[model samples]
Target chain A: MPEQPDQSEQPDQSEQPDQSEQPDQSEQPNAAVEPGPGHRFAPDTEWRRVSPKYLVVEVIGSIITTAIIVAALLVAFSLWGLWWTPWAAGAVALIAVVAIAFEPRRVRSIGYRLREDDLLFRRGIMFQRQVAVPYGRMQLVDITRGPVARALGLADLKFVTAAAATAVTVPGIPEAEADRLRDELVALAESRRAGL
Target chain B: MSGAAPAKPAVDLADGEWHRLHPASPLLRGGLVFIAIAGFVIANLRERVVEFFLVIFAPGQLDDGFGEWSDENDWGRDPIGGIVANNLVGWALLAVLLVVVLVIVGFWLSWRMHTFRVTPEAVEVRSGILFRSHRSARLDRIQGINITRPVFARLFGAAKLEVQVAGQSGNMQLSYLGSSLTDGLRRDILRLASGARATTQSPAPAVALPSVAAGETLAEPLPGLAQPAGPAAAPGTGPATIGSRAGAIVGQRVDEFLAPELDPELAPPESVVHIPVGRIVGSTLLGGAALWMLALAGIVIVGVVSRQLWMLFTFVPAAIGIVSYFWSRITKSLRYSIAGTPDGVRVGYGLLSTANHTLPPGRIHAVEATQWVFWRPFGWWSVRINVAGQSVTSGAEAAQRTLVLPVGTAGDVQRVIALLLPEAAEGGPVAAQIGSGLTGRAGLDGDRFSITPKRGAWLHPFSWRRIGWAASDGIALLRRGSLVRRLVLVPLARMQSVALSAGPLRRGLGLAELRLHTVTGPVVPTLPIIEREAGDALFTHLAGEAVERANDDRSQHWGREAADA
Candidate 1:
């Protein structure tokens, strides 16, 4: 119930357009054009969200996973006379339903912004994380697409550094945008390659 | 050796040429197992082996001599005594000699095939007879060099040299090099990796070869046959006094065993910090053994109360395991010493079999000084470091190697830190800040460290006072945890990225956790539960500083003269 107020307050804050950086729009090529739902923490910097079709991708992926689990459980029941299979399958379906319901909001929450010296990626709603990976420190930048994402023309951009803990992945990017980002990142990384 | 005269330039062993490893390399690298198996087979089947040879050479004599003995001793069931009974002892000895000769020839051939080459750009090693795999570690990417002498290898005066480069499977290992050459070879490689020109190389120190006299004597004649003797041999000892020389080598090895682990010629004559044997034992016990002992005691008490006498039977193995753990810890820390060498910081440990690792300047990614609650009473601190290629190993081996200072006092910690970060140690403020961070309690002072606010106590009730972060002179210090006080220092140049996160609880409290990402190692550089405003400022500051510092960093080519010079 306490989270309700916190969730409600986020929409109002996102609606307010960043007033200070109106004239500097020319500098930020990847800046959000419309005043879409903004990041509550970093309101001034424009954050680019994933494509809306990512929601459909998430739903389809979740449904497929649930179906596989249900099929496995039914097979177990038929073969081994497992009485608990129906209960376990029902629980899996319920969890998948809840996850699918939250798919759109989760997709909306994921955003990445390019700053002067680093790329800042932000994700999650209640437990928010913002990471700034300096362009110089980037060891590699890779783009990967799953079958579902490839059909939907979406790809994931991943940034690798010397530190394994800096696991920064920007998922659900349009395939073309992902390619552009990868090229830019690779060029920037080459220009500013900092050896560990 | 006077300062005024031009010092004799040490011979550079890394001159570009393909060099075979020590003659004993084959035996040290898994050939010993073959020898042992051969010995076991020969010892058990001495009779069968001799009889088979007798059948070929003296079949008529074998039939006449063994016919009477076979009936008397039931030789079919007990063929073990056939050599003596049939009087074929001389033939048995000949067969053993032949097997030994064949094994020696095979080993020599294998040794000839495994060759390594050192170039200005890279150290290349080509090994494996049939598979023929080649491994190369580039000079510029060299992280550190480790020289390890296992007890058996030490007897032969051989050591393993591992060239640590910056990735998984990047280590190039030279299994059995003469121990005398390992020290000089490591220094030359580090100098080359530092981008120092061969012409500008400083006069090498006169390395005393007394410790490896045994190896030198053994390796001397072999190198003469292989190639012209490289400067591996000491001056002026000939084969004329072979009897006296063998006796002298034994005396030297014994002296070497009892001597202090540090070689004065390689590192400083004295260690920067000397940890007493008593303290090492105490620290080991206080570290984890005490907890295990308590658990055991608890179990015993429960068993006694319940009258379950059988429980005592299960306790024996657990008790033995704990005791052995204690023994290993003691042995590992027996002669632990760290000192500054011209190459970098040299850390040596172990009692019988010894390991010496030289971490060159700027190789340390991050450092952490931590104090256990039990150790707090004695003011004991353990220092661990993150080196680039070191994380390839896991568990106890990784833990043991990464610990630069296993246990030391606050003063010792300061000295070790100064050695690790000479750039940060210049003006002494960093050392003073570190000293305070090691022992200081929480305070709301604007100067020194920006500590967690009083309101942040809700999140870290016990450690809120100790939780703080400070950045100065291209280094960031994060102090956290009261129970196990930890101080993490990350050179801004080495930071991979900066991350800020606030979970639901922390968000409500208006605080965030700031992490400075470095290479994966024991040190986790996180400044947890600081003010959200402070976190935001630090994130931006660190992100900018990391890039600028990285651009300005000349630590990679540390031995190379500055551009301005």
Candidate 2:
């Protein structure tokens, strides 16, 4: 199967996505025009970032879970009273701290844009992903609030479509925004779905 | 839209009455299963029962190797005969009676608990004795309706109806109904779903209770006639009415013997491609079954040489299991035929129990036609379509449902292509291009398709020349496979999303794999190890085309009208 590339042609690398610190300006205009008429983002379209309090909620939640694991390990090791138990717990606590500390930046990376006919959500730092859910295809638009999220007055807006792969979740939005977006999405979906 | 109205009661159905299953349904379903088990048990007990008979009735015959070797010296043992003639025979008879009585009770209870009702807009089934579960399927969302009759069920004039619906969940099954009413019910359901009246002033077709027994509804139209008759006065002959009912029941029996062919709307398709019986048998013998047989033979030889008779027992059941598999596949696809209808495609096949599947518009997500290395010489290929709900169900049951064509000629492949996406075959330039790339000879040198770079061939050594992709105005085609050549066609409008990725090896080879995500189905289209530059251009092009196609179809009310009609 190992066949060399034909020597007559040069291997084309022009199509490679520019991974420079700044994306190519020429590509942005083309990407923006590709979605067609009604292609323009809504005049009031704003990329709403998640609540900062969500970071506190995530960190506290992770620390609490880690504490339980540490406590369980300590209880199990009490009989032997190993000298390294405290050190190991300390190491785990440090790891948990480093992991939880990334929550704020990760939360900042998540944003959702409400367009005229669809909703766009982009998330992740290292592995970026953006999904657009057309209003007519929205089977369900739900808001879910876990205990920690509820305490922090934050909720996740989950959009479900016919193909499960197209489902997107805009996490850690303020409770008020969640209600407003959900109502608007439902109304839009109803009108569009009626035509279908 | 949120929650102004209170929750509606679940089971109301357009003023229709709940109908119990036919009287023979219980005997046909639960009782038959018990009977099969009881038959196996009785067959195993036959030798012992025969010995007991000989020892009791004829002591002379007991010397003809009838007894154990230890018992030879006492061949004339009279004490055992007394035991056999007394309590043993009575107890055995009582046990058999109890078992039969239990089976009858089980059947009766299950049948008593289950009932169904058909409304103009939906079909509702309420089953389960203790749990009391109810399921309702909306008529408009119903994707396909399958009516199957097993040989045993046919003898008693019963059939099973499965209603396939949209989405990834929810399928309703009404099993063991009298064969006489199933066709009428099937046609009525399809008509109602297509926005036609099912229960208008006509009671003769769907609700006909044997024309002779319940002649009151005789004024209604006959089913499968495509017209409702005007009410007319009947001759006032009492005996004649009874005679017709008896005749109708007998006619139903004959109809069961020849099922799919008898019902016109759901008839054996007029234009169809039938797989030859010899090809099916030959393919099975030459395919995986050959390897399985060799393995079985090795086990048998090992058992014989080791004098471990018990070892043979293990492999014997495994061998039989393999044999039954081939038997089932052959039976399920013996006379496979697929035909196109105005609304959708219809498939029918089977040896013992025949299944007829009618996939309505907008049901199929993707289509795959494949040719295995062994069957390539004979010009045989199998076609599979992915309907939304059928994939995650039981694998064995899915086999009967998703197979549009188990095996057929080149003509069948084109027919299947037309059936799967009729819109593509209507001389749409891009669609024709994609179609040719799909059904034409598998090669990288096609004019319409872009072949993978030769360097990328390292990733797919066996099938390098076959790896390529072609895009039409509304759809994209991805070709792959070496031994089992496959072409996957995904409508751009139907795609959920797309992805491009390269692993460690792919990066070194300057290649990436492109995945076009549709719903979960039998065929997942992919182009692997293509030039990275080509992958990026294709990705952007497909993404733009998908958006445009979705909007065009939606605005023109094309795809949506068919699904929501």
Candidate 3:
């Protein structure tokens, strides 16, 4: 778990992007393209992956939801005197186990990068995406934590921009980290959008 | 709040005085409900009038329906006409007087409850009898000001001022002000907004005063109509100077404003573009609103000829309602004209209730130019842009507001395109090529872009070859349509997100549709059913282009001062 960087030093970082791997001449300052998983904007840039506790939350939620559905199905099967009822429960348990095993890897694929003037977040495995939101265009930044996430000390940071399609959500970061990132992004957005 | 207080001009509105709406406000706002009620009453009266005719002309028919009952009841036997003939007309007149009194009392009460106040920062309006509610819009966020005069309000020398702001769910409407006052207020606000920006840059002189030519034949000023004209209105209450020296000078030099005085005549207009009546009607008919009108007309005609007079009670009102609905829609855009000013794009249109829209630069999120299939022969097209914060007011009004041009020649399209997207049009392509690219018509310049495969024609039986897309250095253009040709131009900087989707059938044909998400407006921002490889390339290419140009300074600020800011 990487700590969210303090953005008070942004002015320094903005002036020193040239010192970080020649500033990638092929790429635009606003474009954040990732060919595959495990990508960052600069060589020194750190990619913040969601907390592993997110998987625990996911597994618990999955088990509880699956148990409720299976219990209901079991009641119906037994009340109707269906002998293969136990087999149905066993199948559901199997599916839940498989889902729990895959949860961590899926969570690992989601990562976000904070750049000098924009933020980039990439998610999905089969149909991968990388979206960049400029600080000047950001309208709102909201942080929300569900019961499961709250218990696990995690929150979701959502970046809202003028264009609905470009809004990005980075989920399962530690709560404190989420707050710090939100504050920094808000400040940056305010300064960048001053003239507007 | 008393009506006795003299009306204050909008110029002195900065003192934060809470002023009620022009006394005639209720007559315009609540008058609609009253008119509807009156319509019902007249409908009832019309039915009685028809019955009276039947009683007089066809006594035998009347006897079959109500004569037996009339004979059984003495009071009913006389009817109202017989009573009047018997010299009981005074009683009838008293009853009518009582009803009129009740209506007047209603209008008065509604009028008394509504009030509005204007401050330098925001405009606040409050109205509610039981459940009081207040709404206000900050001056900084306001996108435009529209002055509207409905047919009835016009007769009373009143107009409605609608303050449109970015992101607010509803427009802040102040109704029933004098027409000239509303115009003066619009100029005042725009000037103020522009003046505020000038503090940070060089001051540009205000353009020539809005020409009265457009409003002359249309009853420019019903001056005498405003019985209580404000005290300060005699000399025009709006700020007359380009830059007032009333404010305290801070760090910047006062002399800097005096330098670089460009020719005001050479400067582009603050606002001007009008949609002619022919185009307004043409575009509406072409968009299928005409079909609805035709179907309604047929029903009304058939019902009347078949002696189903009851249909007048039913379909005639409905027909009139529909007709008025479309009539209002067409007329609302009748004289559509947009002017480019430092504050924003000031749009004015409408025959009876003209609307003036001030679209500040940077407020517009996306721009798209489209031509329907029917419009192809005439080489006419309509342009619409998406701005932040407008609540989608049904599809029709949304289409209306976003219209940069209701109907325009190809040359007009190019001019508007250039005005809206100077960066994209700068030395990129000729106006004709842009027009052809927009219409998806392959004459000489359309082939400059990539066209869909001949197999893609299977998807668009009506327009296969015409479906194509081209990417310029700063913008991406997608043209699609057969009967209704549409050209969507996405400024790379404004592209929010890009997506590609393919149904099973499209996948089978190795084709997919690419969609670029833009702000809410009339344009759909899509490249429908192109080759799968092309879709992928477009998606990736646009994403990159959008990012590259994300910081492109396209604000409408002018001069070296504008550059510094």
Candidate 4:
């Protein structure tokens, strides 16, 4: 009989994946942790939110989208002949410009603090909600980056749980910060388990 | 996936595409759509067209005369008007042709714009016609990957691949690849993301595990239930070993009866749901409705035959019925084929279009069973799995065809749960302590402490049914409310990362909730169950030690003897 690669047999094998300083190992570095109040994030650590070139990308994308809509309208009118309306495109463009200008900061205002024991994620500047997941309850600490995240030199940290909402997300931070946070969280989670 | 091939990992299987039925599909369909629009437009414009033509004929703004001409006939006008209307049709035809050409071009452009690429590290999706939108996610970030094969796509050999990575995904994307490629890609992606070896070291593959004793051929429905072979096994949670032939027949029956129903929204022909007569009225109604519709259809056929010599294909009703019968036959043949080993489980279903899924223990997120009123007489039930990253919800096409059943029989539920999530599957001695309503000490094992508010009595109302909760590094316990039951299984390792918080009302009540989070595997799922303070404390103490070794880097090289380590 072939061995099934017993992860539980050597509980340690399940602990190995989380090592990465710059090695973008696919996702956030998640490590198991013991359950306790001690798993909170370090109080002093502050998340220096990345400027979100990606946010700007989204806005620029909207602009490009508006432009395309306008160009499409022009071609469409050239063929269909606009009888009842003429300023429709202008009105839409104006509305889009307004929504794009100030929506980004409020859009990506996610904050994270890697305290000694827990991971604190505060997001939505206006409707700011502080979510503190202890390192022990922290099921898996993951670091993920996409093409946009990569371009902005940022990464997303996800805190998964068994609760109905298994995933808590913190986005738009420097890749280095994401790495440190992931490692620290994983290590903390591991330590909690070790105490058990 | 474990032994199919070495260099190449298993990929997701894609749903196929059907020949176009949508207005925007094939050239013929597009043309028909345009014709319909044109016909409606021409029908409404007839009167205006006649007036416009009369204007061309009279020239000197004979408004009243033109109106009079319009009143006489909608589309026809004296000579000049006729010419203009004909010219208008000509222009409209040409314009429609131009539009048809543009639509085709647009479709091709969009397909290209939404192209996606998969690499070892990340999956990149680039979309947009004008503004460039590029999306990429690390392989590990992909929380779950759902692969579906719809019947239409099956016909076309083009399946849609829906990759659900954590963080907001814009929308489900249709992967360009079909069956083989989709499967290959899914396999490789999961292998890389899960941190499992993409290329297995073994030259020989592992033998397929059976749900029964060794030497059993996998050809049919599992025979009778496996005798409760051991004492520790939970009551009713016995192994059901199926023989190869029995397994095949049962599987075929499920494919025939249940597969079609998988897409519940699809109205089978005659609006009839044929079920065994002895079953509930829900099943009986199906039969009566079918017979009644058949009689009515026959009458209509007789009437149609009387109209001009017999038109063959005009029997659309009969055609639909034929197809519906095939669909029903296929459903009766389908059954959920499941086999459980300590390592993992293999679940298979469907007939011609089959889906086989495998998930090892420790990867399952949550499992639940549900029963509808209609199922009362049928003795049937449906099960659901919430694997952290995977959402069984499929696209419109494939959702109709995918297998929701991982295993049949309620008995397999707990064991399957054990196969997927080991922590929650076990029962502990703490039942007595909690039963006595241990005010401040909710858990019996002394692993954790939780206060028993009036809510504690509701924890295990009926023998073991609740939302299971597991602390990250604490004691795992089960909990339930008059309205809800949450069973938590806290591994000592999970207790290390604990957090406590309270909202406005909860704070007033001196009640705070603690959250435990951790993630792993292709499933890389996490669990955080809420408890009134002391319950949280007890779990913390019980499960804390397991987290310690999990943190040590030295233990990391313990299991990779066959791989890189």
Candidate 5:
């Protein structure tokens, strides 16, 4: 676990969200297109910055894994005539380096968007996935920050649904945005409460 | 608290149910972590010479210890086998290590796989770090939430949630959620479920049977309802402590007799319907006697084959048989009570496996009761319900829900019918089907016979004799039969799936049997509409177009109170 200060310590950190900081999709002209009858703009916006600590965690994990493999292989080679030990060690070391180098980029790419009725999260490199959690079925939203995420001024927002096993996670999102989204979900959930 | 003035007071179904973190989620994580660590430990120790010998050469390695240990405690191996085993020890350790890693990784993934978000409207199932999959179940569509905290999970405080759906096997679930989240999800979904009927139109008024509240409804206590101010029962007056000396004695003795293993009773305090100790002891003794006899016979066989005059040799099988018997009996030791009120019914069974399953009057597909030939003399009939989306087995030591009434006569069955399902007992599709089938002596005759055929009908006066099934004779044409002469019924409501079955042989004869799936029983884990599944499926398909078309069957009035048993 990262031993670092959480985002709540930020001097400018805001909890009570102002509506002025609305989604800016200025890059897409089609975004302005009106909803015909049943259609609504996809509820969420594009990705935003993720917690910076994710980079360090990913790199460290990959490096430790690499070191273990290299040490084991060297021992095996010396003792049990392990074949191609040097080459395997080299290949694994190269992977660890690549993973470490790209860690920062992957961390930056993690972000979530809030749509009118669904929440979407976008992550991954070559194969990016977009998840949508519908509003009507929304149960509760929790904003949690692990030690590493806490150091990076980021939080993970989770959307829980009633289905026994479906929870969507928007990980490494900006703490401020995470709180705003949590508020929005709570408001909408309360508003949608069935009539007494 | 008056019923009338509160015009739709609470969000009916919405208000009653709640969700909290499954209490054991963290324990589950810890368990997973332990298993992973255990794997690592195994990996670390796997390559060592002495441990390697322990694994393969040791008798304890085999699941049943046949290849590993000598029956005569002669564990020595040939000189060549020992040396070869030593030479390959390093490779074996490496392989075991690799296996351990894979197992650890798989468990972590599985733990990750079962993560969930439960709400009032629906439950969400999500898994996979790379190639993720997600499934959600609407509250109304969910028959019941079957939860099983496996032995490992129990240690970790984690449990799996499986929802039994209408006309489906294993609808969906989440795993290893902390208890709080699981409870929260259940509550939220049940809340949303309570709102389901309201969604189609206006919500139906939820009937909260007062008696069913704690047990049947699985009351969430509004988060602030403290424990009953004081134990109303005097300090010494509690019926019997489950883990107490007596309970443990009962648990252990039952375990030795082929009973289902006794996990402690898990249903919330309210749902506990206690049975007298005498009944438990009596049934167990009877079952245990039968098993002991079987073990004796096995010993005789073993002795005859070996020609050895050994008293100690027979001990193993006899002990094993006793253990197996205890496990079976403990698992299926049947005891239950139906807490009924005007609103609904809460059926709790098995002191240890007590699960209080409540069905709103609206969600019931059907109810059925049948008596095996042995039960006829004593009038012991078992009742089952066709619940839409009801859970079959959730891995909770007990099954989700089955209302086995107190062993009663036909008259008592009638009263229970009146209390639990007044309309069905008075004559709905359930009552009519049961009534007509019982008195009508109707059956479809084909070229086959049942397990207890009409010929064995009188063999033992106390046995559950087959009623009127004669494969060749057309006299009981009202009923239906094939090789499996099972009877069934389907309410127009809980009809989600329907199909027809005709085996290769049956197809040649140009005959088809309609199979209707109902929610009931852990055995085969289903309720099939033996004779009418096909026709029902086809008609229901069109009825589904309108959705509300079949619900009209609820009002179908028929007088079935006196329908033949």
Candidate 6:
């Protein structure tokens, strides 16, 4: 675990709660692994992370996409003897390698927190998006599983609001956890149903 | 037909009686197809027609040269021409006549079958001869009512009434109703939808039942109104001679085309805000036209520098496109006016082909007041809205339909906002707040709005001082942009969700961006580069407030007695 002395450097504002006073559960060895070196905004709020096995799922997806692109280029080269096909194939392979290397860190960055009235979801490293979807505004709580994810006993939980722009997807949760979360969210949405 | 007299009693259109549309509806709807077919037929059979006329006028001059020329040219390839060349002209003419008759009969039959009925509970329409379909919109779910008079339909004095409901494919259209009756009909429908009883002696029955006898008299007035010439050329009338009557009809049509688009009965004459024609033209020139001109100048400069004179030819099409676009914008916003009525806010625009729509209370989800950089000197602002059941596609028609105020001053924007969201504009503070949002620098009015910190200037170099958000009585105001100033107002109850995002740079600066999700439209409420702690607090506050307000919101049944109370 990283050193805890960094919290002391933050300036104290009277209006803001002292995040250093709360125990940092994320640093615990048994807790879900945290990704990246970015500072958490509301450290007091407990955020649940997705399973580490999701890195394998992401790596597999990237590999399949890279293979398809390379195969297409090879087929074109065989047919027309194009000069740039080999270079394009190599560039694509290099990108796929870099993406696969960062898969573990990307998976660790995904987290969601269930607040009193809404679900706060956070994802991404370079560009972090943290959205709070009110339980009352949720029109749908859906669970979807891909073939590879299903084999690995994982699923993705999605929340849909009336506005098409509020697309929130929490991917790579264990199947049992996903189903339970879906049920809980559906019940909350029902109890606090709000019209558009 | 004495009941069809011009002085007939006011018809209660919402009495649950089935009424047929105007007689000219079929002609207006199918006229384009008929014209295309006629043009095709004429183009194909032009030579045969000329030949027939020649044979009649100059039989003695007919020579074998014509036949030899026709054979050498091999011109009888088209089916119509081939039939005539084969000496089957009479049969072909007969066939064309039959087809025309069949089409007329079909149109007449369809017109007879198409009917609509308005009851207190719902407005229903039934149409189609072969594949009959019925659609109904409940009074409580009505979003708005729009009356559109296309240029051709306007000449025939007919308009289309569309009852907008809050779902995709939920709107019901009653096309080609007599223009004179559409306003009254729309008023009656709105009254019924507002949960108000009809103003007649007998209240409509609670249960909807078709009263055919009452509808029988309703059909008489349509033809009388559709064809004004019928009464003008009444038999044995002394003052109204045939020649004079034709002149009167022409004069009346001219007056209709040139008349100002306003209904004094629906909106008070003084309340309507008219956008001056000069302002419309000026704004158009200052807008996209100026951009096009700049682009042309850039091309000319490049052409001169590169010594490629042929590059100048590219300006021809671009110039034509810009001119046409500018002209279309001017024509579309010629007589734009907006006012508040008892039912809701009424907006009307267009010169020759007018369109008027009434948006009832609480139907507007969000509103945006925007000012382009060029329009800033004139203090001109345009207002757009996010309304349910209205098409949000990007086009001239869609843009005009969604825009409540095409161009207006700060006062006009305030008045429109007051009309659209009375709750937000309450106590007159919204005016000052909006004024600040439009032009106020951040640090000067720091107390009025929660603005982006000075440290976040790197993210928005020129606009950091302008980006801010403020919340008032149940509305959130988001202001941003320096060149094109924008202020988006979203009611708390209408917020779909709230989000906070931080990029790598923002994260290092301890700042986050807040976005209030609303229905898809031109307005995207986002306030970027604010303190992270403030972002969290605002997110929590908005999420809770939205749910609380949504629970208390009774805007759906805005016209109901409970909501009014």
Candidate scoring better on DockQ of 1 and 6 = 1
Q: C-alpha displacement of B517 in model 6, angstroms?
A: 1.4
Greater-TM-score candidate between 3 and 4: 3
Candidate 6 stretches with Cα past 4 Å from truth are A1-55, A67-105, A113-116, A173-191, B1-13, B36-48, B56-66, B69-81, B119-122, B167-170, B195-260, B297-315, B390-394, B445-447, B561-564
| Candidate 4 TM-score on chain B | 0.48
Docking class of 3: incorrect
List TM-score per model, in order. Answer: 0.80, 0.70, 0.66, 0.44, 0.39, 0.80
lDDT of 3 by residue, B1-565 (tens): 1221222223232235676667777767776787799788667667555665666577667644343333324455445544433545567658868987987887787667777776545778888777788998876566666666666766555668778776646677778775534555565455444424334322212221221222221221222222123323433444412112121121012221221111122225333344568877777776656677777778778887998877757765766776787677687766566656555556656665545566655455666677766666777777888775665665555556777777777767776776776655436663434756765454445366576776776777777777777777567777777677777777766666566666656777888777776666666777777887777766656655565566444342222235346
lDDT by residue for model 2 (B1-565), tens: 1121122222122334676777788777676776788789658757666777777688777664433434334535543334454446677668778977876776777788888887765898888877898899987678788878888878777788888887556888888776656665665566556543422325423333232122212212222121211112235556455555555555556555764533454454465576778978877766656788888889899999999989998886888898998898888877566776644577777867877787765566677777777777877777777666665546777765776877777667766777677656755654555444544534524446676677866778777767888876576878788777887878776666666666667877878777776667677778876787888787667755665566554322222244455
Docking class of 5: incorrect
Q: What's the candidate order when arranged by decreasing TM-score?
A: 6, 1, 2, 3, 4, 5
Give the per-residue lDDT digits (tens) of candidate 6, residues B199-292: 3214333111122222333443434454465445664576446545455555545555665566765576564466888999999889847987
Question: Which pairs of residues collide in model 6?
Answer: none
Q: Which candidate ranks first by DockQ, i.e. highest? A: 1
lDDT, candidate 2, equals 0.66
TM-score of chain A of each: 0.76, 0.70, 0.68, 0.57, 0.60, 0.76
TM-score of 3: 0.66
Please state the error at residue A173 of candidate 5 in Å: 59
- True lDDT of residue B71, candidate 3: 38
Cα interface RMSD of each candidate:
16.8, 16.0, 11.1, 8.9, 17.9, 16.9
How accurate locally is residue B103 in candidate 1, as Cα lDDT from 0 to 100? 79
What's the distance in Å from true for residue B137, model 5? 1.3
Ten-residue stretch with the least lDDT total in model 2 chain A: A8-17
lDDT of 5 by residue, B1-565 (tens): 2443253333222233332334445346455676688679656545443444565587465243223433333425332234333465567558869986876676566554545554444666676667787776755455555444454544333445556455434477555553222333343344345432233222213333222232212223311122232233223445423224344443333332222221112223332234454544444444425557666777777777788658546477767777676554544435545554222344544434323344434455544455444344443444455554334554533333543443444454555555544444544444433444432332333312222333222322222232222111001111332222223334433333222444433333332333333234332212212222333343233223212223222211111111111
- Per-residue lDDT, model 2, residue B540, is 62
